[model samples]
Target: MSYVDFSSDAFIAAFFLYCFAFLFYVVTIAGKKWSNRDPIKHEQRWSRISFVTSTLGLIAHLTFFFTRWIGSGQIPTSNMYEFITFLGMAIMIAFTIVYAIYRKPLLGMFALPLVVLVVAYASVFPQEVQPLIPALSSIWLKVHVTTAALGEAFFAVGFAAGLMYLLRVVDFKQTSKEAKRDQFWVEFSLYTIVLVIGFIAIVFIFRGAGYQATFTQENVTIDSKGVDHSSTDTAEYTLPPIVKPYNSTADHMDSFLGMDKPLFEAPSWMKGVNAGRKLNTVIWSVIAGSILYGLIRLLFRKRIGAVIHPLMGDIDPDDLDEISYRAIAIGFPVFTLGALIFAMIWANIAWGRFWGWDPKEVWALISWLYYSAYLHFRLSRGWQGKRSSWLAVIGFVVILFTLVGVNLVIAGLHSYAGV
Candidate 1:
């Protein structure tokens, strides 16, 4: 088979292996219920085997990247699909290192699920390997983007550790209001992560599917030369979408189903070729996410936290704090060099300016600043435990926004991420 096919197969293999490793970790945790011997050795024996399985998954994951690199003749870091996959690979690599040092089964369990989520999330983006855009054709693309992704991977793993800290340290025995609130928010956060995975899964499973409806009334407006124009017009709506053998101009469109154009007349302010369709997809994704989380809650008959937290009992909260701190401390300077310094270098080479206030640039700067402050607060202020873990969690959220949110929400020079 060709390298392209090999890479795709490897990617699929790696995902399943990771899933198996997760199941192994679950076995390790659940086996404690039946063990009549020493808890520590039993945990170690099972967890070590799970770790070995994860290592095999990591190897397959590495093969996926290497094969893609060989097939493409470039580092596959140019688009959302590639970048997110790269982030997943780095997370697994980082997790292995942390797991080696700490040797905690719960840590692997907490961290590996996110590795799977990220790899799964990458699949939601378009995966074709298009030729490089003019601006991205630089040696700096290899160095700058790669280092930045590695740094952010550390941040991602730190988020896992922080989450572990939160779950492990919480006093589930307390029936106080503050304890209840903590429990609720923790469950909500877990629900949100699962919801995102559900959204992507639904979108994929329903690919090329469409449903239709007719709109009774549509309020329309137009701005011509700063003059306001308004009208009430009727149009069709599609739940998924229905396509027709028709073409649409900016001014004229066929009111038909099973076509690319949204039959609905979008509001004048909503500018874009497919603004209505994008809006519809967002609505559908939310609905799908809700459905998935609701089913899990119904089956468990409790909040997700109540189900998962008990298994987290033997994990050390202090280790979670330390590992998170260590990841950030190692990752921060690397983030600074790649995201700030090398990015400016690339901007100068490509755009003929080093410091254009591009939206992506601004967000990258914001991410760097947040991590800097995080390091300062932890090291100088002697912050540790929940306070430090919270900051670690918050820092990764900022890094995530810099990586994904900026690309989706804003339009700028950096918007051409392998599209």
Candidate 2:
């Protein structure tokens, strides 16, 4: 097999190892409640083993990344597959740094699964190494995208800590109505993760079973030079579309919806990269994930957070809250330099405009603004603990949306985003 093929295989192996390591982290946490031995020592033992295994996995994953780099004679940040995998690696690296300082097993328990999920999500995308377009051929492709992903990964850890803080401290049984309302938001965040996981799970099950469908769309646009382009004049396109938009009622043989053909068309301004198949996959995934989550809720006779919170082994909610803030504090400036500053530099070089209000750019700005507000609230208004924690959580959500959502659902200058 070619080196690229070997590297890809190695990548899959690393993903598997990360799954095992994540399970080990969970074992450490759960052992606290179930094991008869000194839970502290037991947790430490498993945590150590988990760290070593994850390190090995990181090594393997790195080897794959570098091998792909060598084989291609270019840095591997030019497509969705490369970018997402690298993003996972970045998150793992950031997690390692934090764990070294805090030695928090709960952190790993929360964070590692996200790393696994991200790697799994990356698998759904096409993995073939393709030649870069002129726009992506610059060295900035490596500098800008890699740095931004790394910053975003650190922000992901903030999300983890924020989540752990909520699970550790938030109490819904309070008699106050406000506390109950706050409780709903906390649970909603967990559901969001579940929804994404469900999306990923359904996609794999369907793909594994060789279930596929297609629809067609015709797009017309005026280029910068004022030249008109039309994909199809007729309502029906002869060639099959890879994905029909979510709002589409095209009335074709839609896979999950199983409709005859959609009767609707996407708006003229709602131009996309034909990433509707992904959207459809996500819809199926939500249905699948919801069923699984429902079954989980039924089996445990409690909410998902309630089930997992016990695995925390009574960690300090305050510490988790602080770590969440620290992560954002460190990550925000880095994110500004990479996602905003470097990205603008690259955009100016490629698109001839520093800021085009692209979806990706706009989301990055939103993340910055949200976190800025978070910092102000925390430091200025004395918002700490739950209030600040929620802001941290929301800030990272914006970051994730900017990282994944804009890249996939809202195609713009950065669509597919290796460029």
Best by TM-score: 2
Give the Cα-based TM-score of candidate 1 against the true structure: 0.86
Q: What is candidate 1's lDDT per residue for 306-335, written digit by digit as tens? A: 777787777777888989888887778888
Q: Tens digits of per-residue lDDT for model 2 on 238-279? A: 222333553443434424444445434444444543545444
lDDT, candidate 1, at 347 = 92
Model 2 is weakest, by summed lDDT over 10 consecutive residues, at 233-242
Segments in model 1 whose C-alpha atoms lie over 4 Å from true places: 36-38, 208-268
lDDT to native, each model: 0.77, 0.78
Strongest candidate by lDDT: 2
TM-scores for all predictions: 0.86, 0.88
Worst 10 residues of 1 by lDDT: 242-251
